[model samples]
Target: MSNVLRIALVDPSDGSREALKGKLLGMDTIWLEADCSRYEFFPDVIEQTAPDVGVITLDSNPEKAIELIQRLATSAPDTAILAASEQTDGQLILRTMRAGAREFLTLPLSSDDLDEALRRVSQMKFGSADAGGRSCEVYAIAGATGGVGSTSTAVNLGCVLASEPQNSVALLDLDLALGDADVFLDSIPDYTLADVVQNISRLDIQLLKRSLTKHSSGLYLLPRPVELQDTLSITDDSIRKVIGLLKASFTHLIIDLSKTYSSVDMAAIESATRVVLVTQLDLPCLRNVVRLMMGFEEIDDLHNKVEIVVNRAGLETGQISLKKAKETLGREIFALLPNDYRTMVEVRNNGVPLIVQAPKAAITQGIRELAEKLEKGSSPAAEAGEEPAKASESKWKKFWPGVKQ
Candidate 1:
């Protein structure tokens, strides 16, 4: 078999189609057999040319583009289908994959990522060994209440994880409308979570990696939508799909969830391998923890995944004790982060992570230890068969009358 790929291309956008054609023509391993500007004419072009691959761009008229893919998939069984789009939305990708597109490419493509996708096609056509699947550890970090330092904890933890050798970590700011994770990291992303969701259909590993803004700490971040209105389009299912895709590309996905406990937040929590609930030694925070724990218990053994961490520990001399805090939640405290106002203020102000700004600081060391403990998978709740906090049950009932024991 000749190594060169004979290609038939279809793209409705004239400019993008020409740009793609130019790229294909430049490749020594690809021969452009035919090109069509319309989806209606693509099948005829493919039939006449009998190219090794049929490249279809889906942005101009997605419904029709998808129809063309479906028709070509059935009518031309031997021709491998390659779907291209500017959008990377997960639903579109799933649909294209289901419609029998062997490879999906994102437009304004990177030469390297394009080459890699083509190489996969080559492997598939000529029968070569495919890459093995990888598993991802997802940690969802939520605050017991607003200002409990969940985002701070998540950012630092993600930085620590990224610092580890051979660890590819992504921090997804799922706080949607109100997330400030980008501000914490001092990253001004060209793309946000909204872009990823809108383009999810074409989202492959390459596209996902490109959509994120990489922090100096070696962690990739997907911040919440830049506009508040954009958050309305971000649904629970979309969050789940985004997480699923992120897992395929990264070793760890750290999610910073909003305190609203909305469906979107719950979806993230549901997908997490560990839910780190960050709180302070205060009545309001502890009460929120108890309420959240009660809700978590209802989800299939999810209580076992909960790990409570007290932030701002010893910030005040009269603050509640750790022992009483644990008793209130009916679970052991996973870790305690020391209060280091001066260092944290500087770290946040400078948009630098704790590990980088003050590696020797007590809070930094505390976060590093927390990362180690998480890696060891030593959750006290998981180890002991403890029921939901009966002590806080009455308080929970007062807040949520419909909830039963």
Candidate 2:
């Protein structure tokens, strides 16, 4: 790969655009390959030119500018984005940086400053640092009831996702009963969720990373309170702060939530980009899934994000059929797993996840496929206000025999 930095710029204003263009054109080492008036043209520009560094102006269009910056960061992780703006206020600079801009420049467009910023951008492209632009997607996992394998699913999913050498995953145990995630991961940590909440106002990416326990597979675990009493000190505000901080540090955040819908649990769920509601096929678990789905229906933002998963679905002892279970819930089953008691028990006793211990097991195969779909950005869950599929209803009725939708 050539060491020369290829660049692109986006500025809506003609005067500022020309000024930036003039400065960038004269640079010796840096080549400016693309420039445009609107931020909308960035992805095409990025694709066509494959710029190592991108400069997008942030001014009156802070909303649009920030959105584009995030899109570019996600769409082209290798590109280092710099947000140039006339407003250099501390708050604006922080917002721009948080939105995934690698460098923020307050503008009258100084050549020396531009050179320095480009130097840092070039370093990012080739450096040992995380090239993901600090972007993350939070997937919240909540079981309908205990022993439904919420922790197993969350921790194993985290491990599977982390198996990708480029992926950085964080697993947060929010059960607040001093969750069993540490036990599941066989992790003995120096810090827990309570410690983060105690110093939440001071928690940043580095500090938060320090508090988490890193597994051998590269998954980071933030254990819940060690003492049951300490769980009382965890508040919703603290959970929100910690989750936000983690989102900035990791590429994928997997949260294991307890059955109780406490404020802290709700905070994580509301913050999640996808909610994985894990349930068994029994009456209680099925009922709980329906109840939770109905409750989620009341919230606009959350209703559409629910991904219903039926764990232990194909066991000979399972009470409900997969088709019938989805019929009872009246939604598509996002994913299903066979009952693998022997493997699950052995792994739990060994304190390791299936992906690491039994990668070829049928259960591991199912979870791995689930991980692939999530990593591929596809969810088979139904949306709010979406009528149950006509085909689904017909098949469901046949599956149920006596039950009516």
Candidate 3:
């Protein structure tokens, strides 16, 4: 019994129960103490066997199954509960977690996923100190407006972070409609975010690693769905679940969000350890930055996490100065990415990141500096009581002559 994980199983479907039992029996570390076909009798079995873990399948009667989990959580606090269901709905996963499930498995479970879940249970029961206390740093990168090079910054930063031997990085493209993080890496991933969400219930480290496309630079990427309609199925809750799983598996998670401030993007932003708001020195971009900052101010502590980055700085002689841009935003500029149109174009066309294409280029060096700043855990030092520039209709109308104000 030393180093063995004892499991009690309950599945209303006899076929599913048999299949799960067969899988469990195959694992050398698992000990199948007792098996039951009904939820009502599972408690009695648990009482008799006193199994270290309880496995419950919820497809037959989810409500009853969840009730059993809740009961076991309180009554058998020593026993870890593992829930299984065919449903991949994010709400169901959230409910299952809240009901005190130590792990959740999707139907027709991947053997690897099941093994990983059991390993987690083993650690929980036996106290594996080596596998404890790992945390992932998530950085959500958003463009102030279209064509502001937000995705470029995210890809390059992820690449640089992945280059460090200490970091295991994953770059998630949240720009569902038009994400090209995979394109930037020159990777045609067999799996995408749609696939991950479809199998969100069984998403363990093994499944997740297999689903992502690993790049030559060592950064793992979960690209957007290939089809436009697939994006419709992706919900905010699903995005949160994905982020949670990614945070658990990787040392660093980089999310490149769409310019549209949708609920999904906001969910990612809220989950992120830091929000890198990439912008430029132009009037339109600056205006959007002001609007976005104002919106961030409304959310609790979101404004503090925002770090404004200026891309393509000094492209034009008439471009806004860094000092003026900071004064306009009422916050310090987090970084100034040098304007290198030729190098960026080459990298984009070649389907490679800046660090790999031209490591010595000024723009590549700028990206490295940005990554260094982030690695050092430096955040924007927003002035006390400072307010972002108000998007006054009068101020903008003067520039465009719309004359609405």
Using lDDT as the measure, the top candidate is 3
lDDT of 3 by residue, 1-405 (tens): 025566889999999999998888655455567789999999998987788889999999999999999999998999999999889999999999999999999988899889788778777766894343345778999999999999999999999999997788999999999999888899989999999999997665557889999999999999999999999989999998788667756888999999898999999999988899999998888888876776776677787778889999988875887877777776688898999999999999999998889999999999999888887775755435544433442233333333454
What is each predicted model's overall lDDT from 0 to 1? 0.84, 0.81, 0.85
* Global CA lDDT computed for model 1: 0.84
lDDT of 2 by residue, 228-334 (tens): 89988888888876886676567789999988999999999998988999988888888777767656766655866778888997778747877777668777888
277-346 per-residue lDDT for model 1 (tens digits): 9999988888778777767767776777889899999887657888887666655789999998899889
- Report the Cα RMSD per candidate: 12.1, 12.4, 11.5
Which residue pairs in candidate 2 have backbone atoms (N, alpha carbon, C) closer than 3 angstroms, thus clashing?
A: none
Best-to-worst ranking by lDDT: 3, 1, 2
TM-score of each: 0.66, 0.66, 0.67
Worst 10 residues of 1 by lDDT: 126-135
Clashing pairs for predicted structure model 3, backbone only: none
Segments of candidate 1 deviating more than 4 angstroms = 1-134, 385-405
Model 3: worst 10 consecutive residues (lDDT sum): 393-402
